[model samples]
Target chain A: MRADMIPLAFRDPVHDSQSAFRRLLRALSRPGTPVSLPGPAEAPEPMGGPLAAIALTLADADCPIWLDPALSTERVRRYLHFHTNAPQLADPRAAAIALIGDAGWLPGLNGFHPGDAPYPDRSTTLILQLPALTGGSTVRLSGPGIETTTSLAPLGLPNWFWPAWHENAARYPLGVDIFLTDDRAVVGLPRSTNVEVP
Target chain B: MGIDLAFDDHGVYSFAYLDEMTKRMIRRAILKAVAVPGYQVPFGSREMPLPPGWGTGGLQVTASLLGREDMLKVIDQGADDTTNAISIRRFFARVAGVATTERTGEATVIQTRHRIPERALTEDQIIVFQQPQPEPLRRFIPHEVVARKLHAFAQYGVMYVRLYEDISRLGHVAMSSDYPVIVNGRYLASPSPIPKFDNPKLHRSRALALFGAGRERRIHAIPPFTDVKSLDFVDHPFTVQHFESCCSLCGAQDSYLDEILLDDGGRRAFVCSDTAYCAEQRGERTKS
Candidate 1:
């Protein structure tokens, strides 16, 4: 595809990105709660609107992103490159943000950077694109953001996902944080959250 | 939608005073900080017009988070009319053209130094704290390398020993302000220099709390409803300051008070440290 054929980013960059970031922040702060990203409806194949909005808001030249095989298409690459100018890295460990199009083939959570002891902020933030936000296996989540306990049943995750998430939570301050997104909404699963599979 | 490449009409400064890249950097750090509650995330701290130690950290964080629709409120030592508070409020208003509020409930974002507002904050509101020091273990262990290792291992004996030493030397825990707390039952964090009276407010707060230390180049956070336990011995539980006297102006007994010296003859009056809360109380009394 030609460079000009790539879809455009936010029309009002300053205000739009700020709004998107605020929504993302709200989603992350309140773990297990789904928040909607209202802007930028257009995206490449396999990349949902919410995920695209998140990428436009956060990914920049400074941040290195890794795309899973399903999302590693030439069209998506050109779109992200045209908008964010963020480098796409082959190594998932080196990526600050990893876009996962297919959850079934996702590697172990330990394969990615859990971050160093002193600086856990250096860890990767995984943005997984799911078919829908809910109606799957139920899991109880409790941690910093949760007042009591909240239940989430994100659809389209692999059978090994929850167990791998348990291992990720075990690392505490050293594990990668995750954002589960559908086409319209996102739910955050921070490292501090404890997931109990019932 | 085609990208609008037009420059922002908000005068010489960018939308919120900080450049887009800088805001993105701080925003990323803030997200990491929130993900790992109480853990300090180092970022490229920018050079604000205001000097260091004067709420520069909080200013940057607020700048990054502020939108045109946001209602900003700034307080210094809980007073809304103070020099620092007024200056910051004015700065944002000029740069971002956002609305400014003195009422705690009316504001969406509240930037504070040394105190949390007396009024309770809701889930919609966010609190930005100005931190001079982000590290709770800095005083106990001067070496950064050793402190990092200790945090990595979750060995917080030094902090407990410090409290023990305080109990041994004095009859009670001597720390009046900036008491250390364990966030999410993991990392030990400094709750800025807020008085012990305000320390309890940090526990399971409904509002998201973000702390920024400019000179230290660190940002940390405590998400809403997070576990923030103040350090204490099992036998001797944690306690807050008690005030026998109420606010002279509004007669608010539950609120934190500031002792004001009226004259050189040693006449003192206790008033609410939170000016807005006191004023609101006075207004309510008049209405009733």
Candidate 2:
């Protein structure tokens, strides 16, 4: 931690961003379970509380972060660009990292590359901030990382997300990975993780 | 309600960038590479802030695929201590917060420019090459159109013509830097800009081969047994260069020699091309 160059407008919340990030990985490798982050940050601009956490957790110069029209602002752009060198792209497909906290404008999750059968992991990871995401949904999650069963709040993806993702998983090797971030948490849904979605 | 005096100040070092999504992209590429084994996939490349020819491409692959518990090795011109090598090694240590190592055997992901390590790699290891141009036909003719056709149909006649031209005109292939090779019979690719001395090392390796060109926006892979063929005329055949000198730093014979200039008298100093390789070999001899 470089104590000298702390940005004045940055989030000083005492949450372990790194630990949350580590948890993000486990969630990604394991799928569907919620992992909490410090979050609830004052996201640069246009973005809300939950979105702030996603940007703080994933933004970097190396990754391409596509900010939707629903959450665009000069302050947000400058902050992300200055901090993480993460270039903002016009198209979501070109993005290495896609940040969509607004449930309404988020693209159909299946529109991005799901991956190829031989190389099924080529899909884009959609980081979606769910609408009131708290557990108690009947969705049964099972797959590569999950042993028996798990459940969580309805991941606020597009209505078309499940059908598209099911087709995606059927292809195997080629598929997208997903991260569902709620108030202060995030979880993964890799293609390998089978979803009953009942 | 309590009055608050604190203002928001974002501190340094946020969570890592290569998120599960991005990591999934690279991992999927790797899994496909494992499945078909050696076919290269043309992926949509992201624009990293760094310029091309820099280690940005390799860094992307390294960042995306690295797990929390992985040791990374970065090498340039075969030496792990080269300034560029050090820069990349430090990059991962800072960003991904992963471990770095000079020892080849300990590293799970070895990001390299030019030559592969003198020590053999294992199945667990992956070598990512920083490629300036991923297309094999760049040298023969700079036409992407024709090159694409050549690669699409496995028509590598032009490469042979160039090699035969070298053998006939100079008695040896006079090309060095970004040598072309046929990977998996169908795809002809460049092995980054490594000198031709490292060409033979690509044969029958246990480790995976991934090539990325950030400027060109492409990523591809070569799996084991993929049959990487360096374009050669049957008559002239393929050849690798060897320096007939010992390393002054760690005196070992039969190693790739990097030319260094000594005093004003114009004397030359020859040392191991692989810096860590030289140190390891010498350390072994001293211990024995």
* Candidate 1 residue lDDT tens string, B10-74: 57679899999889989999999999999888999999999999999999999999998999999
Report the lDDT tens digits of candidate 1 across residue range A31-99: 999999874746778788888988989999999999999999999999999999999999999999999
Q: Model 2, which residues run further than 4 Å from truth?
A: A1-198, B1-15, B33-40, B140-145, B284-288
Model 2 whole-model lDDT (C-alpha atoms) = 0.65
Please name the candidate that would achieve the greatest TM-score relative to the true structure.
Answer: 1
Overall local distance difference test of candidate 1: 0.91
Quality class of the docking in candidate 2, CAPRI style: incorrect
- Give the distance in Å from residue B98's predicted Cα in candidate 1 to where it truly belongs: 0.7
Best by DockQ: 1
Lowest summed-lDDT stretch of 10 residues in model 2 chain B? Answer: B7-16
lDDT of each: 0.91, 0.65
TM-score of 1: 0.96
Q: Per-residue error at A102 for model 1, in Å?
A: 1.8
